[model samples]
Target: MTVPSSGLRSPEARRFLNDRLDWNLLRTFLVIGQEGSLSRAAARLHLSQPAISQALKRLEEQLQVSLVIRRGPRISLSSAGQEVLQIAAELYGTVSRLGPALEEPAETVTGRVHLLSISRIQSRCYDDFLARFHQDYPQVELEVDVLRSSDVISALLQKTASFGLSLCRTPQPRLEQRLVLQQRYAFFCGRRHRLFGRKHLNLADLQSENFVSFTSDQLGGNLSPLTVFRDQQGFTGRIVASSASLDEILRLVDCGFGIGCLPEHIVAADVQAGKMWRLPPGDGVSDVNVYLLWNREQKHTQAEALFLERFEHMLLTTELGERF
Candidate 1:
């Protein structure tokens, strides 16, 4: 057999480094880390004490370090074991996120977990956040597909999506609706538009305004719920165009094509600089929640649960509800 050298460290003595590391053993370590006892780890692994001990021994032998410290019946990890546990967690996590959106691997080398979400929500600055998630668990592959919220749900029901992210609309019992994120839409116009710095503009003021929207094919969608007053009052704006593409929508808004609606996360910078304004109070302007939905099966994955935890935590820290 032949070996190539990077020379940062000598090749490990184990001729079968890849073959020697059993996924089952690393998984056992993680369970022990959580359960904190050999008996519990044994029960969870459905193996006898000897089997679990041998697996642990094989892992330690492969790594050339003792991972667990003996202190009575309760075991704690040594420093080297702590490092292994941390790296194992990260490696296992990475393997679970593989795909175009998740492309970082090199952690555990796990396969793929696919996801679907609405374009509006998908555009809200998650690339940086997801990249950070990739740093710790690079093996997981992730595929993010953009569809209308209605299409997303349909896809989930048809088993086309492992998960879904979208706006919180009128709730239904068929799927689980988790209020994972909050989204607020702001009224916007081009810097060169006639209403650039207007104050106290009422909802009625927008009746004659040109309106650009998402294509009406999307469910619970097309026009934003925020723009309902215009359609309900027997008035329709110039209605020059509609699009599913966010980039095009932003371009149209920037070029003074029409009054535009944008989620709070997407337009915070423009609003801060005084380019967009909220419709004056008492005009029935309101906000909505950014929700996450998945099949009941999706709830079974540890990776998905961790993602929801981190996602909810970030939103809480940002105090998104108070911002609205």
Candidate 2:
């Protein structure tokens, strides 16, 4: 049997991976070890003699553990090889049933799963996603929350949600992540503002204006995206107001409160509806990304697993892979 690499089995202190071990090779190993001959093992498996030998060789290379003693006609297992075979046989028992365990019975899908997001604009995806989730898993319930950027990590850690989405720039050991989209920040002014229809405004144009921003406590950093807004091409702006709520910020921006920094996706619809417009390219703030986060130790509940499965399929098939 092809034993998985492990600190206990290897000469070095490294853990084994599920992908590295080959089950078919282990079956060949078991047969070869039993018959004590390659030709005989090959006959039992109905494989070519060369195939039997190659399988054993690949296993040895992967484990960094020699598994056999070979001569022209005689074959025997090394002591280390014998130990591996015994351990591998036990591991094989579980590996064999893994497929059947997940096959599942055919029935209506039902389960409760929770999801959390960093911003309201991203959470908007859930309105349609949940309606569809219910159609598939009619009895399933999905709870969604929109929290600040920093709270996404905290929510996952505290087990308050099964999935989290946010702008996670650095890796955190406690969580696993999958990239959903890269975000670019944009500047927008209220429809009532004088610059509403103004185009081609340079960084210098924004230098003398006040801006609205996310509070540091909400953004999880010393500086908000305002840093990007204020420093673009050395343009400096005054902070007129700061709050964590995107909806409130957008409304205030609509009410002629102040110019603001926002994700393009967040303001795209409004821009399309002619409620707001983007500033000139070089003067624009940038550098933001959105990621899906979760704790690996606790996998998705049945409902969440199916939701993720469908969501992943949607991304794979659509051109909109970057945003969701």
- What TM-score do all the candidates reach, one by one? 0.55, 0.60
Q: Per-residue CA lDDT of candidate 1, range 19-71, in tens?
A: 66788788778767645688767764568878877788877776666778778
- Candidate 2 Cα lDDT to native: 0.68
Q: C-alpha displacement of 20 in model 2, angstroms?
A: 19
Q: What TM-score, to 2 decimals, does candidate 1 have? A: 0.55
**Model 1 alpha-carbon drift over 4 Å, by segment:** 1-106, 120-129, 216-224, 232-236, 273-284, 297-324
lDDT for every model?
Answer: 0.63, 0.68
Writing each residue's lDDT as its tens digit, candidate 2 over 49-74 gives 99998999887877677788878787
RMSD of 1: 15.3
Which residue pairs of candidate 2 clash? Answer: 2-26
RMSD of each: 15.3, 15.9
